[model samples]
Target: MERMALGTEGIAVSRMCLGAMALGGVQDKETSYAILDRFVELGGNFIDTANCYMFWLPDGTGDESEHLLGSWLADRGGREDLVLATKVGRRPSFPGGGLEASEPLTSERIAASLEESLERLGTDYIDLYWSHRDDRGTELEDTVAGFDAAVKAGKARIVGASNHVAWRVERARQVAAATGAAAYTAMQNRYSYLQPRPGVRLPEGGHVHVEPGDIDYVGNTAGTALLAYSSLLSGAYTNPGKPLPEHYRHPGTDARLEVLDAVAAETGASRNQVVLAWLCGHESPIIPLVGVSSLAQLNEAADGLELRLESEQWQRLTEAA
Candidate 1:
């Protein structure tokens, strides 16, 4: 796997980050372990999870993924070699409370949540700690200070923002600069090869799609990289049974799909691989967060990273619409 500098903090991460959202939830323990092991074998080190993962599922306590990763670390015994990332601020405050009732990014809550996540992951410090979503209700200074305290206390190495718009992210960074606190060095949002029509609301709660401003911001700014989630759109690119969402079903979608098929055929790769390759080689550059259910899927993603598209081919794909 290729490595890249994550932020100005000197932390290095893999080009492809493993999204462990479904591990040990929809996937069994043995299967999750196998997938994780294979990912490491392929030289991947970055893994992302959150405290509220899979909470919407029946009987989920929202701790399955972290708990499973903790067990894996205990058994595998390599805490220092990997870049572990998990999030907070999105978990409900009490049982039966849905996402709307999530905890605020107060100093007290941030402190408490970090302790719980540390316990669940069996780690002394997290490589990357994310503010799962922007808490507009909380004072931005308070949120920045909370994360700065974590870094100063040696609990988290770096901090990031997820599911936030570009302007808000810039505002938070300004606050951090003024307050002399830690600033967010990474941005994670919903991104993929096919884009939904502009201003169309996504079906998933708390999903913020990446916009052109986001691309320009990350491209122009130093020490910041965009980590894209839902990079493959839940297998819609390759699975016939899974159709594109209504928001993405426009004429542009048809044109992009036609070009996508042509590129995949030319490369002799699966549609999923082509999509992943496109993301990795984009002009602004993106670190794709991929979730896998099996080793086959993991291998295909790994192979996609090695694919280098010709300049014309990449341009054609980019200008398809």
Candidate 2:
């Protein structure tokens, strides 16, 4: 796959980032290590994880994914060769602190969060640091100033927003432009044919009203990259045997499947390559984060690297989804 830069931050990364969300938790140590090894073996240099990842898992609560990646980096002996990204705030739901989205991300929380992430990842600097979620209660100025502080402190290289709104992201860039603070260089969101389920209105009370292009709607306004997580509906498009499970299937998923099945039948490409290629085909710049559990699966997912689908094919898939 061709490598893409993380916005203007200049951090070069593979178009397909290996998301380590399931690391050290859902998958065992051996399996996680094998997945990492396979990821690198396939020429994937961009790795993503978080301090609170998989904290909701029955087996983890703290930097499990980071610890696993850190350990693997030690074994691989080339931490410098990889571009790593992680987040702070909103860790797994603790008993009283349940991993609920209600938790706030404040400056103090960010500072403490990074220390733990650094310790877990065995790294001195993070290529990209994200807020993970928008802090609706926190002032935009507070968020911008805090990110500026992190860049100045040498703890984080670039700051970005995750699970954020287009207008909020635009205002954040405005905050930076107004005060010369650090601006967001990327956005992380769960965008996929299945996740949003086209035409399906998001649940009313929380983080809703997110329209299409919100990732780039703000990016085009600020010139940042849109980093897509759950890019392939958590790998549902690739499985040919059974339809996606109840929760995994989104409204647009079946439509995308129809096109994918046709493409798979024609080009001899797997359903995943077709779906993933469609993601990369968007008008808004999309860099889908790839998450895997095995070398075989990694290899399978890696087929999307540089696999550019035709315009008609892209349209077919887009229309289906």
lDDT of 1 by residue, 1-321 (tens): 999998887888899999999998999999999999999999999999999887878988899999999999999985767999999899999988898999999988998999999999998899899999999999999999999999999999999999999999899999999988989989999999899997899989899999989988988878899999999999888888999999999999999999999999999988888888888887675899999999999999999998887878788888999
Please give the TM-score that candidate 1 achieves against the real structure. Answer: 0.98
TM-score of 2: 0.89
Please write out the lDDT profile of model 2 over residues 224-294, one tens digit for every residue: 77777766655556565655656436656666567678887877787777667777888777778878767
- Report clashes for each candidate as comma-separated counts: 0, 4
Name the lDDT of candidate 2: 0.74
User: lDDT values of the candidates?
Assistant: 0.91, 0.74
Stretches of model 2 off by over 4 angstroms after superposition: 92-96, 101-103, 198-210, 215-223, 240-254
C-alpha lDDT of residue 318 in model 2: 66
